[model samples]
Target: MASTPIIATLLKGMAMGAADVVPGVSGGTIAFITGIYERLLAALKSFTPAALLVLKREGWRPFWAYVDATFLCALFGGILLSIATLAHGIEFALAEYPLQVWGFFSGLILASTIYIGRQLHWRALVVLVAFCVGALAAIWLGSVKPVNIPINTLTIFAAGAIAICAMILPGISGSFLLLIMGVYPVIIAAVTEFNLKLLLTFMGGCVVGLLLFSHLLHWFLQRYRQPTLAFLCGVLAGSLSIVWPWKHAVVTVVDRHGETVPLVQRNLMPWDYESITGVSSAWPGVLTLFVVAVVMVFALEYGARRLQLKRAANAA
Candidate 1:
């Protein structure tokens, strides 16, 4: 972790930011795949009251180093930059090429699930049970129908708090949860319009949620490494349903912009999709993207492994 370059961390952060923008994809999955999940969790977990004491006694430089401020700043800067630049582009892609976009993410998560699963000691009963439980939970979450609630300060804050917690989990998506809570459009509007008051409220909730949840996750990872990994793998596995390429909206809702969008969708087979929706399935293109995404994941894994081995040899 210490030897990782700043640029690499920034790129990883950018990847996470991109994933977070997608409804079914998770930024936590990106962090885990890039081998920085534990480090990221530890950094977030360090912002307790004790950190203030360190700042008071040891001064700025020591405090900064102690909390790994440089790493945080670089990573978060990348995330903010990515979100600012890519949000509209991704929205356009999702609107115009929904099948391809969702197919790519579905493949990414499928490959990630396999990669993470291989790291766990699956022979253990506890790990197996954890995996099953995680899978079931993720499936249930994916099946939840979106609700339209009145948007207010308190609701936005609550949505942020709940969504942020899921955002940091490998299988769950914060954006999807926001959709389920009926605040996703409002949050997107706030970002695009630079609504400072709403953005600040949402961010405050995110801060509180991150601080509270990080400790529990850190403890579980430390104490039950294999089971935790297994559970995360299961989560990634179950999340595939949410990102499946072929889906038709079963329920729709109108947002503030008066745009009618999917509130609930049901997955469909490639063949059945055309029949049911009367839209071309474009199965070939979607399949091609899925294959490309799968290959990209394995390629990334291979490259990361080679880099690790080279670094280990140099250290030795």
Candidate 2:
């Protein structure tokens, strides 16, 4: 079977990693937009007990072939490398230019919502209901207050499982889910400090969650693509609240390092933010960035389509 170039897959994975680091933007959206979503899901779904049996019976080469190991390894290596290299830079940007960062992500997700919604041909009431439910659920989840939880092995494992599942779902972010669960800081600390034990535990949970959830999601997409897409669109719609550029932290807590962090925040209008914080609203800059993000998505889509057409012509 023809396969995507390793460099291309690695770049896609890096893009996904960059998205996954943000609160509102989803790696799944990047995977979808980059035309790797189905292929990634299919690769993940290849990991079954039966495949393990083949590993034992047919040896390493056949097992690797069955699992598409080369693609998975290249992609996942890129993801890990991205996280390791970009995490601190992303953290700095979010701290220094929160509004711009949020604006960019909001715009990206808005474009994704439109893109995904356009693919759905369903006009059924049930699909609409699913969309509404997904939106409402995300809105509520976004509003929930973060609770302080002890950083332990079991908690890390559980956080990994939940966060990983969200990470792969369109419009849901693993890092955001971690923030919601109160483990974001701990996980970030682990990554920055090179805490191997904690990292390994979290990764184990991620592997388990990714394998299981990918199968379920793959099946759903295959059987009910329209409704599934509608639901994802709704999720992206609802997540906008979480990424709103202007907000005031209503409740905050001092962390282990004595840095103040928001535990709960309330969305604010641009004018209201200026009124409360006595800072420039920078509305024009935000709007410009948002428009740029939207245009970037469309440009990426156009390029991907052209590439596909070129490939088809060559194959013919």
Candidate 3:
């Protein structure tokens, strides 16, 4: 409720916004590492029909209390601000330095897998199988080519629903989901161009999907922590296929903006990337950035742990 706490929440939301923009990274991962994941789920779960009834019966203040509106507003305000400000910068980086950008994301995800996997009370056989299944599904999904669908209200709405669901799930990237659905570019364009009508439609779908999926995920996590974590670890492991630094596009398509982009790509070694793309590959730079990403995740985890300890000590 204090300005200081609100500012901290806003910063966390900004971090989540930055992660969500990248293809292989999930905002949910940020939420987890920042120590807000469970609280966020609990807040989302508060948005029940009973809450709405309370809103009608007791007015704005009671409704806000029922839903933790202050926290949600601050968090989402930060997310939207980050997205609006960072969209072009992220897009430019991805275009101008694809290898480095992806390398960083790859490192972040790899670290995330380790971080989340550690939280599981591992049943060796079950965890392994869950990890494998998640990885295989992500790999298969990565290999699937994007389809060219006619952009209409319904299509945009559906894309938002699906993408938002993925976005909130740890190890699953919502932007990657959009890319797979062939709507990433459209959505990016909408954001950059300030296309309010298209943005609103997509947001409506996102709201619906997020509300429903958050509740389901909350239940799943509460009831099946180990299995859920295992599956998420697997998802992160499998998603590596999508963020490999060196890749050659196996299939390409022209988007609505008449720009050529990769539809399907085959992973390549650094030397092979140089040979194929005729670009310097810059292996040193890529590796350095990748390491930086990994270190950053660990630093975040350490900070969050310290904060938790401090809170506990103060309460005691």
Q: What overall lDDT goes with each candidate model?
A: 0.87, 0.87, 0.86
Q: Against the true structure, whose TM-score is highest?
A: 1
lDDT of 3: 0.86
CA RMSD of all predictions: 1.4, 1.5, 1.9
Error of 2 at 205 (Å): 1.0
Off by over 4 Å in 2: none
Q: In angstroms, give how far residue 133 of model 3 lies from its true place.
A: 1.4
Give TM-scores for every candidate, taking all chains together and pairing residue i with residue i: 0.96, 0.95, 0.95
The TM-score measured for candidate 1 stands at 0.96
| Colliding residue pairs in candidate 2 | none
Per-residue lDDT tens digits for candidate 1, residues 57-145, read 99998888777888888787777778778888998999899999998888889889988988988789999998998898889899898
Off by over 4 Å in 3: 1-4
On the 0 to 100 scale, the lDDT of residue 91 in model 2 is 86
Cα lDDT, model 1, residue 44 = 88
Residue lDDT tens for model 3, 105-148: 88888898899888876767777787788888888878877887
Q: What TM-score, to 2 decimals, does candidate 2 have?
A: 0.95
TM-score-based ranking, best first? 1, 2, 3
Model 1 weakest 10-residue run by lDDT: 1-10
